[model samples]
Target: MASADDVQRLFLQALVSRRVVTKSLARILLKKCVEAVKAAKEDLDIRIPDNDDSVNTFVINLNASLDKLDLEIVPFVDGLTGNQVYVLANRKGDEVAQVASDYSPAELAYFKVLAEMIITAPNSSYCLSSMAALRETQSLKATFTKTHGERVLDTFVARGWLYKSKSGRYSLTTRSTVELQTYITNTFPNDILHCTVCHEMVFRGIRCYTRNCEGVLHNHCYAAYKRARQTCPVCDTPWNGDSEGKLKKVGEGAFVEGQDKHARARRRVDDEDEDEDETPKQEEAPSRLRHRRRGRGKLRPKGR
Candidate 1:
């Protein structure tokens, strides 16, 4: 019969192989690992329950085992989609630059700038348009052309470091949040905003409409908040749930009225090009849209 330690070792190896995985995927992997371990020896007598609780037990034990090595399995809900994700994260150090070990120095420099721009984007849009991203390449000291920059950005998307919207705007993926959380919070302390309801870091969410009110909530959190009270948690101002395009600068610690520039530009471009397939037929109307935007189109991050 395979011991519990055998199963834990197999699960840890799987997590190390895939640094980030959806909770559902992780659960499936856990089952597979148990099966593989059981097959390693004659395990017909000892039957381990193949249920969700098994994962919880495995995670707790594995984390304790990994504590000395400064590695842990971190679980977080995706701010945009609310899906649970598990990350094999390093618990020590703030060397986010070393996360993408495959990239060269020049590529790493480009990635840092691109990520910073997306993190500190104005109006809390937390997005970088394709044009704006490409333009940033010219300002980099490492000498990247628009073509090279575009390719690098594509690679980032492919490697799961960034999410590229159909509209051509780019934002950090949950993987980036998991791996770079420390660097992001430390470097952009003033830019980071936590949910007023859940208190988790919010990349995109609703903000209180009242000027000088610093309340912010994730979309899911806002839905729950609105059901009980139609007011901002921080300032007690009325909220009508139509607070879109009202995010203010993070430094001001307030809410201001304005639409996202990228969204506006995307609208303008769509209007100008009627034949464009910016919004595919498969997409829902903006009113019914969820996490991802139905808007139109950024920069080059290197060698993700």
Candidate 2:
């Protein structure tokens, strides 16, 4: 049997290499690590059991060691898919500290600007069209060119910081939401929106139609919310739009797709694609701590 420490080290290595992984993937990866350790060490002390509780125990011990290094494994329910994910987070430091060492100053600056734009997007789209994002470099004082912008976005998507949808829109991935949660909340306290059902920060989701009520709900949560009642949970206003919350797009009547099987499948595939790069060679720049002063228009849902 492998020692508990050995199992923990093996599991931590896998997590650090991937940076982010689904809970299901973590379970499978952990099983492999334990088996490898058992094959290598014959007389190790401490027998680690193969069970769900064992994973919790491993995380507790690993976090104790990670504390001294200002790093810890964080688990959060993905807002889009509702599947839990784990991320290696930097505690009490810049959210992008780990990746900052590899990127240049201009790259970092462009990332900061782009991130703010996505977060503050009108109607809480929480996404930017690929074309708009590519052209963003022209507005920056930094020496980032359009080609650099393309590469940076692609790299960030590959690294699990961003997700590129089928429509070529870019939005923050669950990894970014978990890692940047504190930063986003603090920097955009008033601008940030939360789901009325789960009460957690929501980037893309449904919204209620009451004129002054700022009620929003994740697509997954909205389904259950609809089954329970046909009114706004916050203001008790009668639900006006379809269950999908098809609000008017910023420039058109485009509707963001709900969390369907296709969306979940795409997210799973994105995670699998990250397997090629065990360790991220480059990452986004440091997130600026200051609040962005910008105007945002409210999204008005069309009545059915």
Best by lDDT: 1
90-171 per-residue lDDT for model 2 (tens digits): 5545434534446666665666655666676556677767777787677666677888889887777877777888888887
Q: For model 1, how does the per-residue alpha-carbon lDDT over 244-266 read when each residue is reduced to its tens digit?
A: 34534332122122323454455
Q: How many Å off is the CA of 88 in candidate 2? A: 1.6
TM, every model: 0.73, 0.74
Name the weakest run of 10 consecutive residues (lDDT summed) in model 2. Answer: 295-304
Residue pairs clashing in model 2 are none
Off by over 4 Å in 2: 1-3, 43-51, 92-100, 227-230, 238-304
Error of 1 at 241 (Å): 7.2
